[model samples]
Target: MTEAEFIAALRRMPLHPGAHGLMDDSAVIDAGPLVVTTDTLVEGVHFLPQDPPGDVAWKLVATNLSDLAAKGALVEGVLLNYPLGDSAWDHAFLDGLSLALARFDARLIGGDTVSLRGPRVLTLTAFGREAAAPVRSGARAGDALWVTGTIGDAGLGLAIAMGGTGPEALRDAYRRPQPRLTEGRALAPVVHAMMDVSDGLLIDAARMAQASGLAVTIDLDAVRLSPAARALGGEDRAARLAAATAGDDYELLFALPPDVTPPVAATRVGRFDAGAGLSLFDTAGPIPLPPRLGFEHAAPR
Candidate 1:
């Protein structure tokens, strides 16, 4: 069967509470008082075989946890959907996951297991509590654009892993990406809208602006880069990697009113203008946007 057809099989299963449909990773359920979120990651798509299983498990769990973080949800627990390979592989993966869960007091409730003929896939459903979680489309036109942590490190880290002249210190960027959970939780309460930067910063910025019905203008000179990222491109070439092709940063991107100060080391790289569409401004001027796009899934590694 085709991939799409294979996915359609889950539709035959009986639905339960919180299940949006058989197709969703997250379900809407009442946890006494809040909403929740869940996300999943596949083997080849989310991580490389060369990457350690420990890191793979962490990424799988943390990526979903980041979603809850964006919504100001206090993490209650996580349900792991682990597709086993060998017993040893599964045990080691869980060992790594145990460390992360313990760090946040998140217990693994329960999930099903299945054997796969192909590569490994990890799915996680993270539940949290909040009276009102941050929604993606709540920003106003004058909301300030901000992000926690520096951009481009993870992108350059991937380049290094793929033999693109990046340093070892930066290599941890690909091996271990930190989900800005605390930052997201803090920002959600005050900001208009918030999201974690899994894709390239410029692209995610554009998405936030678009979802909130405003234009985003990023100042190329204003972006903060890790020393490792700066060393990779050399001199002043951040404009080359600032927004395009970078992925897995896992930091929060948010919007706040003009008068508010960011709680973290947030940079004002852009603004929500009165119009629609994103404008990337470098010293030379605004770079023309690519038609109908940003970093899409499987657009050539």
Candidate 2:
């Protein structure tokens, strides 16, 4: 089954109210003021086999925390599910996990380990606390779509990781993505809707539109790009399109009223309207949606 199909099937089973219909990034359970999220990374898929073990561990933790960030929650702790591997690689991963936990102000409370049977797979579950959390479905008509930080650097970075030449900053962007925790906490109170740009700006924005029952139009020219990205990929229409569809950017995407200034730095890339789908435009005119909006898991045949 496709990922979507699998999720749809899961929805048929009993679900906790906090699951948010299995739609949002994290599950917010009110009992403990808890916000929970989990993410999994697989070898030769989420990360290259040759990638540093420490970097892989960092990514596993950071990606899960990014979900908490989107919920505007403070880090409480994490539980890791690890597979036993080469002793050297295991030691390196633990070292990286220590650094990541310290950097994020999160504690490694507990977890389980198992023998590796095939490709390495790592999972992390993060717990956080916040009185209130925002949901992606809160976007309303006339809300301005905003995003934190730059886009597409990681996409270019991935290319460099695979032997293509580019700046070290881009390589780091791919290897170590920073979760916008502070930005999420600050924006949660003011933004109508919020989510991290994990999959891609275009696809995630489209999802927000679909969730909120509104339409969105993104101005390609308005999408932000870092100097490194522009220097390597150029700032033309193609570059902007590539950036919009490139996933792994963990920056927050939010919707706010046009008149209100965001408490944090953000780029206004689009606006929500009264209709129901995603539209794209540039200085020239409307552009067709790309065949693939972002990264999606394909089921084994």
Each prediction's Cα lDDT score?
Answer: 0.70, 0.84
Clashing pairs in 1: 18-27
Best by TM-score: 2
**Estimated TM-score per prediction?**
0.83, 0.88
Kindly give the stretch of ten consecutive residues in candidate 2 with the minimal lDDT sum: 1-10
lDDT of 1 by residue, 189-236 (tens): 888888878777777787788888888887767778776666666536
Clash pairs, candidate 2, are none
Q: After superposition, how far is residue 192 of candidate 2 from its true place, in Å?
A: 0.9
Off by over 4 Å in 1: 1-30, 163-165, 238-244, 290-293, 298-301
Tens-digit lDDT track for model 2 on 1-301?
A: 2345434533443444566666766554554768888888899989999889889988898888888888888887776777877768876776777778778887654555677689998888888887258999999899999999999999998999999999999988888899988988898888899988888899899989999999999999999999999999999999999999988899999999989999999999999999998999999999999997777661111
